[model samples]
Target: MGGRLGGVGTGLALGGGLSYLAPQYGMACDSFKELEVVLPNGTITTASATSNPDLFFGLRGGGGNAFGIVTRYTVQSHPIGKFYAGTLVYVLDHSQAVLDAARDFIAYNTNPKASIMATYEVLTTPDVLLNLDKFIVVFLVYDGTEPGTAFRNFTQIPHLLDTSKPNKTYTEVAEMPIPYTAELSRADNVFRIGAHRIEGAAGLQRPRELYDRYAAWAAANKGLYVYVALNLYPVARSMTDASRARGGNAMQMPDGPWLWVRYILSTPPGLLPGVYDKVQASFRAMVEATPSAPGLPLFLNEAAADQRPLSTFPTYSRLQQIKRKYDPDGFFVNRTGGWTFD
Candidate 1:
């Protein structure tokens, strides 16, 4: 949705992805040296730490569309080297253990080089519910061959599959079979996505509850859709430390480790007429049922339409000022697709 290398530009703007590497090298925006932007009037300008500093600050971690067209991004580059990468799969039978391990891993592990994205999903078909097909797919990566003590909890989990790759190039890892895609056509009908925050000592309970609710919701509405998946991505605050080090950005994160929970549901086009309202309602219910840490922000790239990613930013007022300064006439505001401060 944000442009590939898989949302590399938007990730820089929203303080998303690269959480595992963030504490070390800072976020994608920390290295953002320059951007060539075409404003509403077709005026072209360059922004960076040195020139047009206000727009530079505004562009970093401020959701796209609200600003202007970024013709080119001049970013600081890092050396490409071999790294460890792998995928691990486990059946739903190990859900309890896997969930527990994920909680513990984020709560205790302090390694800056290691990162893991754990997704618990139940694939669906027309006749079958796909529980037997449920899987907790985990992506593990480290700057080195070994993920070290930080990832032992995940490695030790009983699993049905493990395809760990060592010394793989960044491009190879990017090309790996990650489920994220660029498709926009709803050949499968509308997909309702939802995002929520999960954190703290209740991290274990909140996630379990959300998973159970989504499971029940899908089961009750199973025949209407093809699949529903719950994705859990870790949001470590160490990433924020890095963001702030680079003069900060718009995404003001809460303290400690948190989980960016997203629910994805698919329904065949026009299969169930007028069902979208009910479906969206159920999605909202699931989000409302989840417990979120105070001030936790949404990752704009994955957020649902109704979810207020802009309001979640602690720097809301500052962002509004920047928006006014750049586009006082609200040309971008009326024409863009993001949640604006206005």
Candidate 2:
């Protein structure tokens, strides 16, 4: 039942399946290739990069829920092997230093073989802080082998408290328990509210002052607010760039090198509304404090509701044209609203 597909093939099938059926299958935005969609009036249609190329590109990352009902997909496959991956945890007191180090490490990261994800957390109980209050940086080195060389390079960081063994499956690595999964789910009715913020006008390139203010806010609101996880992924340039060369586009995001930062704000259900408002205000203030730049495009699935319109569709006019040509009736619409074909 298992097979490997190239990024494009993988994306189409995966993205289509998840959007239509199991979201738990995760998103296939990065692996889309072709789609079989059911149009209004029960008409069935097929699209690929070669035939009906416009619809193919539009569905790639134009978002699934807003692109008709995809029933089948033909994706490209590839040979994938074992990879080296693990997480490193640190204390809350060192949040700033750890974040600074992680940012520096990623900004200059040149290892084509290694990928890293760095995250931060704020805990309610001092005990949770004592147990898991630190920054957890997950490192994955894809060399198709175990105990790869990248682990050695990462171990050089003096502050790391612990590290996991190298050889692991991509599924194993991706499914690793992120911070506060249980608490996050329990605090809100919709996972949408509990999801991370990694895109939009709120890019990770926050100014030093904003970073400092956020840290101070976390410290002051300790027990009431719990968990802020910032994730930074170092995907191989070849993986993203190749998609573009093949007529696939989502990866053509902003120019500057960027890190994906996710802030997970949670409070007990009873205290949720007030805390949510405060956190939103803080986040908004943080974005307003920074200068605007076309740094990174928002990952639509993970984006906050009020992000800039163009962040999701960098080429709006073009995307709209594709939408019009394929979805003439505009039957496909986003659950959160705002997207229009005309």
Candidate 3:
């Protein structure tokens, strides 16, 4: 009924979504009612709309860098039941067909009763017996109490491997071990054109050529390439609406249907400049292929030094104002790669 997934908890603690409704009903962070913070000078403060309101608004989505230090976060709780969830892995040889199927699914998928996540990746391990390349797809469907119905809908896909189960808890699904790791340094590249949200027939257009190139690159760069994952999550319209009511941020992409095309390039420790250049080239090609590419919006927490400046969106301005009010001297700063506001 009510439980917090530690993995999700760790994610939120490290600047992921914290609102109970977020993981439960796809709610946004600003929906939460309160937050508890410790000031730079060791002053304990509790904030909400009624008390310490400024700090409360600031911490909602403002990058949690300089607002003293959040030792504990008291969040609103929600009741959720059993749901359907699992991952679908595909071989590298079927990458083209899989990508095509995924595009079609997202385009014609009108069912509001299901939530699906599609990820494409190439896995390679140099331990002699573990090296392989393939396209892995993960689908998580939250079908209220009807897990069977959700599983049936997904089974329609002619997938190489389908692993759908029933009665799975939200925490179990949220904490499901995805392929990538949090600690490992990754060379990530993303290219997105048009609006954030695509509507109707337009959302169905498949980027076939893009998939081909990605697959080819992954194949050629075998062992050193490590892994690649392309994730598409429907940012529920309700989530967007809630965020707007709570004083919006720059994350307003399109409002229709959007996919997160993520390319995770992990390399061996010793393989330096050569591997880095190749990965960089792959990213460049991807961007060049896009018509109106807006570069990449680096995640503040995962961003490197050069990537830090890309985080300066309209939301950053609002976050800064809030930060100045509560953390004037910049105390609890943990912005990845030296991000600061002086």
Candidate 4:
């Protein structure tokens, strides 16, 4: 779920290595049957999906610290039981019927073990008569149970809080109160966090113009940032048919069903030197007025380090010819950091 799915070695890598269940169990390098790596010049090797197999299709969803360093992996583990997870809180006046019931449950839910991660937040109110504060947080999961009619229209909305939990165990639904904060420099430290994310893949439409482009970037950067969040998750097709029966990885989805959009920002690291350039020009004008779904793919560890992620992988020219056939002379493309292969 976090740890960018093994620190971007590809599983759920969207904080930097690009993955979110790898289109459903096919990302963390398609459950690497083996690894080992080393190269750059230190040369130790081993890959799988049939031995080197194009560096095992460029390490699953490519860009996990940009290849050659793995030193052991051999994944593929699945087997648990109880399901139906938790977290559900709503308020902003039922947020447009919870964003129209998550755009009709990811465009007509068919229940592929139903899932969701909806959110919509805005905060900042010094009480000069309360300036702003809104909410709609949901983090559901239904491997199956708890009135699971594929999340009965988000459990019939009208919620102010609904701590759902029944037949749990994905490590007890990853220990509830969900807001995956992996030790952000010791929690409870005011705000000042910047996760200005922008993910596309808008299939099955209904981007709802990304919540009217984050309510016009929170009414033009309210209070210079203390909270602002947006997210939605769904990408079924049985997780891309179980990542194409495991013979295909390197994330590429557009045939159908899709949705993944993120926009997060929080401030107060002493208001980052007085609202650093109107917060990067209001998050690049709300990512140039959000809209995408053309070719899908794009999640690469939640992009924005100058956003390239193997040019949004449609196998980016066979992952740049498998990174010049395993670092021909690039040495893991000049020693580290990912999304390379130009």
Candidate 5:
């Protein structure tokens, strides 16, 4: 939830934003009731189940700039009372155990109230799998004050830091792990996303393998990068049901219990143009080591511009229809940074 909050905007929410509460409710787009939008050719209109339904469908999870711009949103709001939540940090030595616990949590955690995100941070180069160059940061949240056995797997681990509190405000929970500051904003950050199905025990190995390969890439590209991260997000069955109950969105997410990995790489601030391309080529190769498991839609909230997320949605054809109707002149397509319609 580190980058998901601090302040969620129209783009983030419409682009399938997620949260600790997602397990209980659903993605941010599922909360929409109505939106007032400005179309490519300057028409002003409203979108919702009752009005402009096609536009509503495409705008929900099809949130790249290809769609019309939303000027106002009327969304569903939930109670944000105190909850049991906080951050947990572990050293590289405990990386395997921590990752194992995370995988098990994803596979077996059935509580809708319990949601968590695990991020393995590679802060330096020359990271040899089990060295001090890496560490893990996890954010845990339970809707109620008593998590019961929900967090035992993490608590059992001997960690370097634990900032969890039984009673935490919504704002406090959003800021756990780290606060979003100008320094972080200014970093040359690029994110690639991976989606994998949680098929029995394969789920356990997939995350671990992805993280290992990512670390290897970082080690091989020593000076080209400053920091790298692999953040794991669990999509629960309850979450999928919630989404469907809300009329479903453009992503057409299949039944849940799937995984979305956010791969972040921060290159040096000012690399020469040619060198930058090499770094990008290497990063692309590293991401290809584990492609998304065929059907899941890549997330736009954190995905790189070139990921072409729209094409992966099950409702791709429907979205295309919506695009042509809304922007017959291809105005948004020509001027904005959004998913390609073709």
Candidate 6:
């Protein structure tokens, strides 16, 4: 049940894992039964509910490198079967429609069997002719063979591509969205996230405006980035229920049925020294403009290096205490690049 639907792996403990099965089960971090890591003072130890319980608490949903380097993880396992999932790519002309559909899904969806991630991506290379670069890609997954009406809203939209199929393995479902590893690693990457509650019309409508604004910003400043994308991740009530059932996570997440809009912009190989900073600042400001809903926890894995994702956690104060206890002298705080505990 613990996997990259929210993170990559054992590191998920730090990032607060949100899996495709999060609604049915719980976050990936919630699956951890035990972990062995090298603590700040170079002592190797184990963390679990009955063992180094304090470390275990802080380690789940707490950002990494500040606590310890986890060498092994003993996680709870679940039965799995083929999934119904795929990716749908829509033309920019369908942007508003797709966004509307996504909003509707977020507002009312209660199905523990279904999961979706909507991303509007813009290719920023100057030579990429036409408006072909603009498109929206959605990842839909149903735990069973038939989704029933869970994804009706999305499937109704006019899309340019559809890859969803029945009876696919968990790994295949994860791989539906192709990984651009080389391009991602070599680029200048920047990420920012905004969490919002799924409220009435006004609250729900805000992200649509934010989406339009993001696209316009990327379009105006083309060539400065290899690509800029706006991704929408839903936090359903079922997901929260599952997380809470497992004694809650380090985030101490409040009630769910919310949204996290992830902002990602990557610059091509090189940019003039001063230009890079300015562009990044602009991107940061754009995300900050929307802000997160009060009491909501931002996803650490998707957050920017400069953002204080930990501060948004309801467990902030206690996490600070645990941070002081585990790395007393602040060696990790001084040496590593992560959220500030102070």
Where is model 5 more than 4 Å wrong at Cα? 1-3, 125-130, 179-185
Better of 1 and 6 by TM-score: 6
lDDT of 1 by residue, 250-321 (tens): 675655566677666665566555686777677677666764455766766666656667777787788888
Q: Which stretches of candidate 2 lie over 4 Å from their true place?
A: 1-30, 126-134, 146-153, 159-161, 183-185, 189-210, 254-256, 272-275, 308-312, 334-342
Go through the candidates in order and give each one's C-alpha lDDT.
0.66, 0.49, 0.52, 0.61, 0.82, 0.81
Which candidate would rank higher by TM-score, 1 or 2? Answer: 1
Lowest lDDT sum, 10 consecutive residues, model 3, at 189-198
Q: Count of backbone clashes for each model?
A: 1, 13, 4, 9, 0, 1
Model 6 misplaced stretches (Cα beyond 4 Å): 5-9, 126-130, 179-185
Q: How does candidate 2 fare on TM-score?
A: 0.74
Error of 2 at 261 (Å): 2.4
Per-residue lDDT tens digits of candidate 5, residues 1-342? 223467655678778879788887788888889999988878889999999999998888788467787899898988777899888889877878888888788778899999988988776546555566777888888998999999899989999888888888887877664522214747577889989876867666887788789878877777777777888898888888888998988887888888899888887777898998998988988898788998899987878878888888889899999888888888876687657686
Candidate 3 wrong stretches, greater than 4 Å: 1-8, 11-24, 92-97, 104-113, 125-132, 147-154, 175-177, 180-195, 199-203, 206-210, 242-254, 273-305, 309-312, 330-342
Q: Estimate, for each residue in 1-342, the C-alpha lDDT of model 2 and write its tens digit.
A: 011211223333322221210111222443556679875546788877676777666676666545566788665544446766556666555555655565554455445455555655555555543555545554433445554454454465555555465566666655555566535457641111111122344433342344565566666666555455444443233434444545545325442344433445555556667677876677555544543334344544444556543344566668777766666766655332643443
Q: After superposition, how far is residue 309 of candidate 4 from its true place, in Å?
A: 15
lDDT of 4 by residue, 1-342 (tens): 233223223344322232323344644445567777776767788888678887767776675456577767777776557876777887766777888788777767765666677877776544234323776778776765654477778778878678887787666565555443323423222211111122343432345666776767777667776666777766656666776787767765544356667666656455455466568566756754654544666666565555564676677898787777677777655666656866
Residue-level lDDT of model 6, residues 2-83, one tens digit each, is 5644335556556887777887877788888888989988899999988999888888888667688888888889899989
Which stretches in model 1 have alpha-carbon errors above 4 Å?
1-20, 126-130, 179-200
RMSD, one per candidate, in order: 3.2, 6.4, 5.2, 16.2, 2.3, 2.0
Count: clashes, candidate 5: 0
How far residue 238's Cα lies from its native spot in candidate 1, in Å, is: 2.8
Candidate 4: regions farther than 4 A off:
1-54, 64-89, 92-110, 125-132, 137-148, 153-155, 159-226, 230-244, 247-263, 266-300, 303-325, 328-342
